[model samples]
Target: MEILVCVKRVPDNEESEIEVNADGSDIQRDDLVCSTNEWDNYAVEEAIELVDEHGGNVTVVTVGDDESEEVLRRGMAMGANNGLLLMDDAFECSDGKGIATILKAAVEKGNYDLIMTGAQSDTGAGQVGGMLAAMLDYPYASLVNSVEVIDDKKLKVGREIEGGNQEMNEIDLPCVLSIQTGINEPRYVTIRGIRKVSSVEIPIQVASDLDISGDSVGAASARVKKIDYFVPELGAGAEMLEGATEEIVEKLIEMLKAKGGLK
Candidate 1:
């Protein structure tokens, strides 16, 4: 059961103040503290645990600049057997689909029994896992919270549905799963663990190495883009009813009556 887990480096919201850049295109990255995406850590941990029980190897992959190597190293420190970095100048400003395209190429190059990705990125977009599964023509499940081995060809995955219910389904092998946090507590990567994997060689794959064409990715190819990033102005309809709980409830009733929101 060889697993490929996709990890990402993201801003540490707790460690840095996230602000929109002056151009309103993206977040202010310079001086921002960054680390492995929290959800990706859980994904990598899940893969390692699965491999531990089922007998296989876990490999972590990420697509970013050289600095992004840190996240791969962290994943390796957490017990992944190998780390892979996909970097290329042409991969800059890639949208979700572009990232998925790059991941698809890497997946094609590996004989993985399972593929895992974080349920969502800090950017709040959970599109890549589904898109990558679609591009690879593999079955995919998102928000997966539990995994059980049914056989070499099948796996029982549990997902948390609405109303806090758990839904279980049997998915075929060679599938992709977007792992949800709380699936398990990720093991801590101690200094000793980091040092142990410090000298391990992590391979790098570029756009050419992955057979990804420049025109198909990067800023020029992005169909969806952030042209601006600004907070929406407060609407006139919004009201703050300040008082004791009872008074506030009465005030809310009056406002609702005035607005025809309540019968």
Candidate 2:
């Protein structure tokens, strides 16, 4: 059971404010603190648990610049066997499909039985896992909250659906699963574990190394383009309508008639 878990570095914006950059297409990230994507931590923990139970190696992968290595190291501290960093300037402007292209190339290079990723990123794109699965032509499931390995080549998974429903299915191995949060509690990275893995060298893979064309990734290959980006303005304050129900209704009707809202 060689599991490949894909993680990402995201801004810790829950405790901080977000500011749009000058280009109006991205966030102002210079002063922001970065950490593992919250959902990806659950994915990492699930992978680690699977490996611990089945006796296998867990390799955590991330695609980003130099700063991305921090998340990989954190995964190692959480008990991943190794780490792979997919870094290149060409990846900077990649849209969902472009990213999937690069990831598929790298995943094909490895002998992995199962691939896992977060159900959605903090950026809220939520498209990579499905795109990657399509690119790999692998069986795919999203919003997965539970996994049970049936055999060396099969698995039974439980997915969360709307209305608090759980959909259960059995799928073949060599598949991709987008893990949702609450599947497992992620273990904290201890200082000792971090120190131990500090000296472990993480291999960086570039687009060329993965045999991915420069034109196949980045902004040029992107299927979607950001025309503009801006935060929504705060709307007008609420108005209070206090009195008895009949009086309130009468006042509302009068106001609506006065405003030409009613015939």
How do all models score by TM-score? Answer: 0.90, 0.88
**Model 1 clashing residue pairs (backbone):** none
For model 1, residues 49-120, the per-residue Cα lDDT tens digits are 998998999999999998899999999999999999999999999999999999999999999999999999
- The residue-by-residue lDDT of candidate 2 on 91-164, one tens digit each, is 88899899888889889999999999999987698999999999999999999999999999999999999999
lDDT of each: 0.94, 0.92
Candidate no. 1 TM-score: 0.90
Task: Indicate the residue-level lDDT of 51 in model 2.
Answer: 90
lDDT for model 2 comes to: 0.92
> Candidate 2, TM-score vs. the true structure?
0.88
Model 2, position 10, has a per-residue lDDT of 88
